[model samples]
Target chain A: MRNQLPLIIVFATGLLVIVTFFIPHEPFGSLEQRFLVWYSIVAGFTMLLGLDSLVRYHLIKIRDRRSGWGYSLVLLSGLFVTLILGFYSWARYQSPFKLGSPFMYLYSYVIIPLQATMFALLAFFIASAAYRAFRARTTAATLLLVSAVLVMLGRVPLGGWLWQKIVSLIDLLPGTNLSGLKGLEVFARISDWIMDVPQTAAKRGIYIGIVLGGIAMSLRIILGIERSYTSGS
Target chain B: MIVNIIGTWIAAGLTIAILSFLYKDNPLYKFAEHLYVGVSAGFGVIYVWAFDLKPMLIDRFIENQGVERWILLVPAVLGLLMLSRWFGKIGYLSRLPLAFTVGIGAGLGITASIQGFLLPQIQATLLPLTTINNIILVVGVITTILYFYFSRDFKGPFKYLLELGIIFIMVSFGASFGYTVMARISLLIGRIFFLLSDWLRII
Candidate 1:
């Protein structure tokens, strides 16, 4: 009965949602929104479960005097301090996100900069990868390299200046009639086309497959065939 | 004003600390990383309480009357039951809430996939083959879909179609990569701007 009850609940709720999708009656019409509200509230508690796991891990590391326990100490201190400030802000101002609040200050200074810098670090890594891996060794590789370069050029201001200079140089050469097709606009047009037609086609093909797979998986879950959730995986 | 200046300097120091990881993994980067995880988690807890629980559940329960007020108890109970997982004995009870969430998720996925993804994508793909672009679009979609069809060995013309599909896929990936690189570069630029303009007053 341990597993069966959950499975039954899954089936009932799944079927209920599916059935109500077609109905637009007064109660049923608002049912999905109502369920969404309930889901968010439940999901909010799940965040506490996550917070428990994070805190426990750090606490264990610190207790055991593990290799990076100092860092864990830093982490726990940051967490607890932020939490105190957040709750204090909420209590005093009725919103944790009030302007000029300590929580907001930490958010603006610490979180924003840290997260942005973290992602910004990826730019350097991507550049390193481009230098090593973006070789045009084969037809497919060449196509990829060419497209990437064209798109990159189409995006940046430097690309326009370079394109104009190249066009001028080409015009300087004897026996050349490049008049109207003169700037980075050509690259932009090609980039747009690449994104619009072929890219759309490929993405649509992938999306169709994903949708079909999702439907099948949903069916499996609804039927209780997919039991990974209950198994704690 | 003094507080703002101190905050800017702190932000700059953190940004520099994170950026130092590009040179080599160091203690500074590690400190920043750990602090980031903690702060983000703390923010999430407050966010969930503020946005989700406080407004949706507690406020709604307090504001509504009769059945509506009482109905909020169902989710509140389910949420509490999820917290029961922390206890060794009542952990099994958590599965009920998990099951409920999964069921709702699956139901939503089925309908949303059909309405949002499948039909729309199919409709988008169904273009007249009059123009060369249209022909390419139609053929690209068909061949790409056919590429994933591994039921039988595709010999002769089908083989070429599969190859064409891969080319289309590769082009799409290339475009995606280019866009991603640009986005990363822009983010980097933002950081640089903050460092130079906000922190150093150099720009």
Candidate 2:
């Protein structure tokens, strides 16, 4: 009964929300807005579960005295300090949190830089991957390499200079329609052509397929056939 | 101003600590990584409690101010039911809320995907067969769609069309890869600027 009730609630709310989208008048429209806000609040609640897992994971590492478990102490300290500071700052409505209150900095100084730097590390790794991966071993690979090279080059000024020189050579041939096509501008034009033509085409087809797949998956979930979320149960 | 400068230095130092991982795994990198995760999680904890739970759920309900706001109880109950997973015997109860979440998610996905992605894309693909560019775009979209069509076996011309589809897909992927490289380089530039201008104050 416990399991069945959830599924039933899922169906009820799911159908209600979908129905509300179609009927955006008066009570139903306002109800849809409320549902969205409620959804976010519920989502907010899920953070507790996430925090629980994180704490448990770190505590276990500390308890076992796992390799580099000393770092776990640093982690716990950072967590508690940040938590207390954040709450205190909010309650105080001080600088950084409230802005213009002076430099009571935590998020701006620590979290932002750390997150940005962590993501930036991907730059080095991806460049390394591209070195080995962009090999032109086949016809398609060669075309891919060419397109990538053109795009990378065309995005910068050097490609424009080189392209202008080539176009000047082509300019010797008079009666040529350089009307819409300007010298050096051709690099950007080619890049745009590749992006707007082949890229857009492939992207559209892929997006349509994705939408269909999404609809199918949604239907599966709505129909109670997709039970991956209920894995343990 | 001194506090702000000190904070910037701290941030700069930690940023370098993370970037040090490129040489090899070390304690500085581990400390930075743990600190980032722990602090971010802590921030989220405070954010949700202060912003969502207290104001939206607890205080509003306790004060009983906004009459219509009681509708929030539905999701509140559902959300609470989700936490039941921590308890073993009542764990089956969690499935109901999970089911509700899944169902709403699916419904949301269906409507949004159709409205946002599928229809607009189809509308855009209906280009005039005028220029070479248009022709290539039209053919490319058609061929790509045909490649994804799994109902039948590709024979003769269909096989060739599938090959053409792959070429288009490859080019698209290559362009995306190039753009990704550009994006990553921009990030690297950001870090370099921080190191030089902000940290070292050389540039």
lDDT per model, in order? 0.88, 0.79
lDDT tens digits, residue span B1-203, model 1: 99999999999999999999988999999999999999998998999888899999989889999999998999999999999989988899999888888888998988777887788888877887789999999888888888888888999887998999989887877887888899999999999999999999999
Highest DockQ scorer: 1
- Candidate 2, superposed: residue stretches over 4 Å from native: A94-96, A100-104, A164-183, B54-67
Model 1 chain B: ten consecutive residues of lowest lDDT: B111-120
Off by over 4 Å in 1: A175-179
In Å, residue A219's CA in model 1 sits off its true spot by 0.5
lDDT (C-alpha) at residue A164 in model 1? 77
Instruction: Give the distance in Å from residue A232's predicted Cα in candidate 2 to where it truly belongs.
Output: 1.5
Superposed on the true interface residues, model 2 gives a C-alpha RMSD in angstroms of 1.8
Q: Which ten residues in a row are the worst by lDDT in model 2 chain B?
A: B63-72
In model 2, state the lDDT of residue A45. 69
> How many clashing pairs does model 2 include?
2
